[model samples]
Target: MWRNVRRPWTAGRLYEETLEAAMASRPVDAEARLSSPPRASILLDAEVQPMGPLAPAEDIRTDPATWDPRLERAYYDGDLRAGEAVLELYSRGVDVSRIQRAFSVGAFGLSRLRRMVPTRWSITAVDDIISARLRERIKTYDWIPEHRVYSLEAMGNRWVVLMSPGVWTYESIEAWYPGTTWNPTEDVAFVGDWEGPLGRVGYAGMGGCYYAARLAVTEALERERRQARVLVLREIHRDQLMPLGVWLVRESVRAALRGRPARFDTLEEALEEAGRHLDLPLRFWLRVSETLGGGRQETLSRYL
Candidate 1:
C-alpha cells in the first residue's frame, strides 16, 4: 500500500501503517529529545515546519454557478466566524462530512482567519461545535418514555447505546482488549468521560471518539424531539489491531441508533439487554461509568 499512495514525493517514497507500527519503531532516544519523534522512513528525508497560514492552489478558483449560496457567501465574507458558518451550513441540510472537508481546506470562516486545519482536528471541531448547539435545543425536548438499548457489532468492535429517561446528559466508555490498537499490555484497559446537565468543560479523556459518538446520539434525539441520559459502551476486540479514524465511532453509532432498539420498562432491564452484546460483565462497566451511577438527578442503581 505504500507504493500505491496517490501523492508523489520528489525526494523518496512514503509508508503508511497503523499507529501501532510507528510506536513500535520509535527510537531509543525518542523520549529524551525535545524535538519530534523519529519518523519511520526508508531512504527518505523530510522537513517539518511550524504552523502557518496555508496558501491555496492558484488555479483552484471558486465557481459561483455550482457552489451552495450560503457557503459561497461564507467563503468571501470577512466577518462570519467558523462556528457560525458551520451551524448555518448544517441548518441548510449540508452533510457534516462535507462541512468538515471544506473547513479543512480553509473554505469556511472569516477570509482573514481562514487556514488549513489538520483533518483529524477539524473533524472533532466540527462535531463538537455542531453537537453543542444541538444539545442546547435538545434540552427543551421531553425525555424518552422508557429505557432503550441499541447494539451493533462491526469492524471488530461492539457498540451498545443505553438511553435512559432523563434530561440531556451523556457519557462514552471504551474497553480495549489486550492486543488491540490502544491497549498493548496483558490486561484490558478501561477509560471513559462524562458530561452533566451543564455540559462538559474540557476535552474528554477518551478523546475524539467521545465527541463523535455524542454527535451521533444527539442527532438521533434531535430527530425525535426527545432527550435522555445517554451512555455509549464500546468493546474493542483483539481483531481491531489498527487505529482507524474516529469516523468509525460516529458512523457505527449512527447505524446502531438507526436500528430498532429493544425497549425496557426499567433501567435494570436495559443494562441487562445491553450486557448480552458486550464481552464484559455489566458490573465492570458500572465501576467506571458516572452517567449510569448518578451523574444526573436519578441513580440507575446502587452498584458498587
Candidate 2:
C-alpha cells in the first residue's frame, strides 16, 4: 500500500487497514522528536485544499457559474452550519464502520485529518486500530517507551476542525482553483493542526470551511465537556456536497438532533431551533455574534 499511496494525504483512498499499516510503521514516542511531520511522499498537495474558502467572497457568491447552486443554497440555508452539521451525525446512531466509511474521502477530511487519523484515540475505529498497533509495537519491542496515548471521542464526525495556519500553507495549496486563497482570518473558518500522539497536538490555525464548519460544534463540545463532536457532512468539499443539507449550526440544533429518530426535516427549522440554543436569538445578529465570537468579536466580524 505504501507503493500505492501516490497521494497519501489527498487523493489516496485510505481505509481502516491503511491506518493500521501507517501506525505499524510509525516510531515509538521516545523515537519521535519534535519534527515537522513525516515525509509523506504520497501527499497530493492540490487535492487537500478545498475550493470553497472563497465562498464568502462577494464575487464568487454573486457569480453562480463559479459556485454550485446546491452548495450556495445549502450554505445559506444553514446546511453547512457548524453545530447543526455535527449533531446530525451524533443523532444518526451509526456505528464505527460508517464513521470509517465517512472518512474514506481522501485522508480523513483535511479539517479533521490530524484529529482523526494520527491521534491515539480516533473518532472512528481507525484510532482504535492505530492504538492497538501502537500497543502491539510496544509489546514487541522493549525499547519503546511507555507513553500516555491520546484518543478523542468526537460527539459528531462532521464538526471537529483541523484548521490550517499561515499564508504559504494556504497559497501553496494552489491545487484549488484560481483566486481561492485559504482564509485564516475569517470567523467562517478557524484553526487546528494534524493529529498525532502526545507530543503531536493539533493547534489552532487558519483554515477553510471543511474545518470552519466544525468550529462551532468544536467550541460547544469543549464548552460542555462533551464527547467528540459528531457530524454528517456529505463530503468535505462544497462543490460536491450532500442533498438534504440541513446543518444544525448551533446548540439548539444539536439538542434537537440528539432527540431520537432524527427529527430534522429542513434546514430553516434547524437554524431556527439552533438560535434558541444560543444565548441570543437567531434574528439578533449583534447579540448572537458577541456571544458566539467570545472575545474574538473584532476579528470574526469581518467574515460574518
Candidate 3:
C-alpha cells in the first residue's frame, strides 16, 4: 500500500497567503511559531525613507549586540514565519534597511535552527518578497502607450530595459564576462525564467539578480501607473573583476529607470536604439534573449 503525500506550496503562493494574512490581521500563527519569549513590539514604530543604501554584511555581523531583542526572539522561534511577521512590520512603515540588517543576522527565520544567511541570500529574499507584493499592485494598472528603451552603465555592467506596451511580463538576460563572478573563463549568457501577466511559475535560475532587477523595473511601472512587457539586458565586462553583490544590479537598474528613456514606435526600433549603448552586438543579446530572440519572427510579423 502507498501512502499519499501532499505537495508543498510554491514560494509565491506562500508569500501571497502570508501577505494577505499580514494585511488582514496580526499574524498570530507566526508569533506562535516563535521559540523565544515575546516582546511588546517586534519592530518599533519609526518613520524611514523607503529606499536607502544597504549596510555592509560585515558591519551587521560584527555588531549583533545592537539588534532588537524582540525581533531576535521572533526569528529564534518562527523562522520564515517570523519573516512574515517582519514583513507585516514593514507594511506598517518600519524601515526596510533595519529589517534587512535583522535578517542578515539570522533574526528572521526559525529560532531553533537559526543560522546567519549569507548577505546576498538575505538581500534577495527581501527583494523577492517586497517585489512580489508590489506585483500584486502593478498588475491592476494600465499598459504603457509606446515602446521605450532605457540604458545605463555602472561598475562595468551595462543595463538596457526594453518596455513594450502590453500586459505585465518580465524577462532578464545576463551576459557574464570571462573573469566575472559566475563566468571565470569564457564569456557566457543566461536568461532568467520568464514571467507573464499572471506571474512566474518558479524562482529565476539566475537568483537574486533577477529579483533585484524585477523590483527596480516594477517600481518604475508602478510610478507611471502603467504596466509593460519588460525585457532587461545586463552585460558584465571584465572590468567588473569581482562580485559586488546583487545591490549593484538593483541600484544600477533603479538609476536607469530614473533617467528618461529614448522612445520608439516599435520593439525593433527600441532594440536598435538600445544596441548602440551595449558592449555586445544586438544580435548576440537577442540570440540569448528568450523574450526577444526565439519569438522574434512572430513578434515582427505583426509589424511586417
Candidate 4:
C-alpha cells in the first residue's frame, strides 16, 4: 500500500526491540528456575537425643583379631541397623570405649556404607550419646545440697569445676593462652563458652574438649545420683603446644571429681574459691559466662 513502509531499522532500535520481545516471552523452564536444590538424605535415623546409655557388653572382644564371628556377621548383615547394632553391643555390656574403638576401626555400620570414622569424631559421638542418656537420668535426681568446687591440672590444662545446687544445667568456659594449640597468634587470653539447655549452637570453639568435659561431669553426677548447675573453667597454658586429644580433659576432670570437692555455702563463695586457681580475674569469667553472668544479674535484681 504505500511505498513499502520504509522505516530505518537502526542497530540500536533492532537491539532494543529484540530485548523487549525476549523479556516479554514466558520463561522456558520456570519450574526448574524457581525450584530449590533437593536436600541431602540423612545417614542415621536415630533420634537426636539418646534414649539411654547402652548396657555394658559382657565378654566383648575389642581386638579385631579376636572378635567373635557372630558379632562380625551381625554387624555386616544388610538387615541389621547400624545404630541398633551399636546399642546391642552396649546392651550386651560392651564398654562404651570398646564400642567407640570398634566404630573407629570400621567394625560397625551399614554393610554397604561401613567405613572408619575418625577417632576424635568417634569419641565425641559416643560421649554425646552417653551424656544425653545420663542427662535424662540426672534430671530426675535431686540437686546437690551445697555449692562445690573441684580443681586439677594435667597435660598443660587446668580445670576448675564449680557446681551449684540446682536443676540440671551445664556450661563450659575455656581460656586459651597465647601460643597454645588453637590460639597461636593471640597475645592475650582468649575465652570461649558453650552454654544453655540446647548446648552449643555448633561445634564448640574449644573442639572436642567441650564434649569430653561434659561427659566427665555427667558421669560424676550420675555416680553421685545428683543433679546441679555445673560450670567448667579450663585454662590452656602456653606450654600446651601439642594437641592432646580430649582424653586429657576427660580423665583430669574425672580425677578431680573423684577427689574431695571444696564446699561453699553460696555461689559467690564458690566463684571466689575457684578464682584463686585461675589466672584471669573472677570478673572476667563472670562477665563472659552466660550462666554465671545471667545468674549474677538476676541475683542482684533481688537486692535492688
Candidate 5:
C-alpha cells in the first residue's frame, strides 16, 4: 500500500523542494523578514497547484506572437543544434528569459534528442551560449576609444562596470559584506573569476553571476560593435540580507550600461572613478581583479 501511494517527484518538484530547503536553512534574520506574513494575505514561498486538468491560456495558444519562427524551425529540424538555435532565436529578438524557459523544457532541439534541463542549469547555459557567440563577433570589432565606467545601485547591491580599451577579456568579482547572507562572519568575503582573450575553459568559480554579468557586458559591446576588457565589481552590503537570484546582477548591469558612462582617457582614471562609488578601496579592487590588475597600466602601456 505504501509503495502504491508513493511516486517519484518530477524535476520541477525536486527543484522547488531544493529551493525551499535552502531558504529554510539559511541562518539570517533577513530570511525571517522575507518569509514573514503581513496583515493582508499575501503569497510567500507558496506553490500553486491546479485542482483539475491544466490547459494553456487562449492568448498563448492562439496569439500569433506566441509563434516563434526561429524556435519552430529549430524544433522540427533534425540537423539544427540547440546552441545554434538559441543564437538564432536571440538574434531574431526573442527574450532571453523566454529562451531560457523554452530551453529548460527542451523546446529547442531535435525531437528525439530533447530532454528537460534543470532551471538553474538552463539559465546559466543560455547565458554562456549567447555570451560566447557575442564575444566572437565583438572581438572582430574595433576597441572602445576610451575607458568607461558604469555604476548602479539596487537592493543594497552596488555594481561597477569598468571597460578599458583592449582586446577582449572579462572578469567579475563580488565582495560580500560582513553579516550579509553569504558572509555571516565579521570579515567580508571576496570571490572572483577571470578569462583572457581566448575565454575560459571550465566553469567559473563565481558560478551563475559570472555568466550573467558577462552576458550583459558582451551585449553592450556588441551593440556598439566595440571590444574592451571588462571588469564587473559587485558589492553586496549587509542590508542586502538575503540572497536574490543572478537576475539581479544581469538586470542591474544592463541598467548601468544603459546610463551615460563616466569616460576616461586612461585605465587608472577609470578605476579611480569606479572606486568612488564602492565601499572598498581602489587598491583592494586592483588586488583581486585580474582584468584590472595592480600593474594594469604598465601592461597596457606596452601595447599602446
Candidate 6:
C-alpha cells in the first residue's frame, strides 16, 4: 500500500530507501571490534639482559644492539652458526647465524670449526658431523647438552664437552605468541620470533637441555667468583644464549614437579632443595631469579 501510495513506488526506490534508513540509523563511531582484548608485546626475560661485566665495569664487553645485521639475518634463516671464530662467525648474509657483540661463541662454535678444518668436510660431511661427532659429544659431555648457565670463553681454546642427555624433549612450539599481523618488511627486526622460525627453533628446543647448559655454566662461574673450585671459563664460539637460557629456571621447577620427589610437591620445594645443594652465593642468585649477572652477584657488601 505504501509503495503504491504516492505514485506507485518501484522496487528500486524501496531498496534505496531501506539502505538510506539503515545507514542513517547506524552510529557514526561504532567500533567493529568492540570485543577484542588489548594485547601488547613484551619480552619474557627483560631482566635477563646482562648488566655490568664479567670482570669490572670497565672490562665490560660489546654491545648486542650494534651487532652486524647481516649475520643476524643468516641466523634467522635455517643455518646453524658453528665452527671456529673465522669460519663460524655468523653473518646475516645467507645461512649464517652471526654472534651479536659481547655474546661470545665459546667452545661449541670453536670446536665445530676445529673439527671442520681438520676434516676439510663437504657440506654433506659437515651435516653428518652434527649428528655423529656432535651428538657423541653431547652424549659424553655435560656442557654440550645445555644447562641452566653458560660460560664465556676465549678463542682457540681446548675444552672437553659437558652435558647430560636431556629428557622432556620440546616436541613443538605451537605459535609465535601474540603479534602475528605485522609485516616484517623494511629494516624491521623484532627481538620477536616468527611462528615459522620459532616452530623450527621449538622443535628439538625443549627445557631440559637448556636447564643443563645454563646450570653447568652458572655452577662453574659461581665457583670461580667465590674462588672455590673455580672452573675455567670456556669461550662461546657461536651466539651464546646463556642469559636467555636462565629464564627456564622456572621450568626447572616445573620439570622437577613431573616426578615424585622425596621432599615436596611445589616447584618452590624443588627450588629450595636445589638451593640447599648449592652454596650460599649461588643459591642467592637462584632465588632472586634463575640467575644473576656478574655485577648483580656482587652486591657491594662493603660500601665504597
User: All models: lDDT?
Assistant: 0.75, 0.27, 0.66, 0.66, 0.74, 0.26
Per-residue alpha-carbon lDDT of model 4 for 168-191, expressed as tens digits?
778888888887755757665655
What TM-score would every model get versus the actual structure?
Answer: 0.77, 0.18, 0.68, 0.69, 0.76, 0.19
Model 3 residue runs over 4 Å out of place are 1-80, 92-97, 109-116, 298-304
Q: Rank candidates by TM-score, best first.
A: 1, 5, 4, 3, 6, 2
Among all candidates shown, the one with the greatest lDDT: 1
Residue 126 lDDT in model 1?
A: 91
lDDT, candidate 2, 10-117, per-residue tens: 423333333333222222222112224444343222213222212111111111123223222322342243223223333353332233333342223223322233
Pairwise TM-score winner, candidates 3 and 6: 3
lDDT of 2: 0.27
Candidate 5 lDDT score relative to the true structure: 0.74
User: lDDT score, residue 302, model 5?
Assistant: 34
Find the number of clashing residue pairs for candidate 5: 0
What does candidate 6's lDDT look like per residue over 118-192, in tens digits? Answer: 111222222222222222233233322222211221222112121112321111111111222222243211121
- Ranking, lDDT, top scorer first: 1, 5, 3, 4, 2, 6
Preferred candidate (TM-score higher): 4 or 6: 4
**After superposition, candidate 4 runs with Cα above 4 Å error:** 1-64, 68-96, 110-113, 198-202, 298-304
Better of 3 and 5 by lDDT: 5
Cα error, candidate 4, residue 9 (Å): 70
Clashing pairs counted in every model: 0, 24, 5, 8, 0, 35
lDDT of 3 by residue, 1-304 (tens): 1011111122334333332332222222331133344444332111111233322221111111233444544444663564575667566665544555555544555445444454566677778787787788888888888999899988788889999988788899888867765675664655466787788778778777888889899878877888788999888888875566677788889999999999988877887898888877777766666776555767654333
Show the lowest summed lDDT stretch of 10 residues, model 5: 1-10
Candidate 2 weakest ten by summed lDDT: 165-174
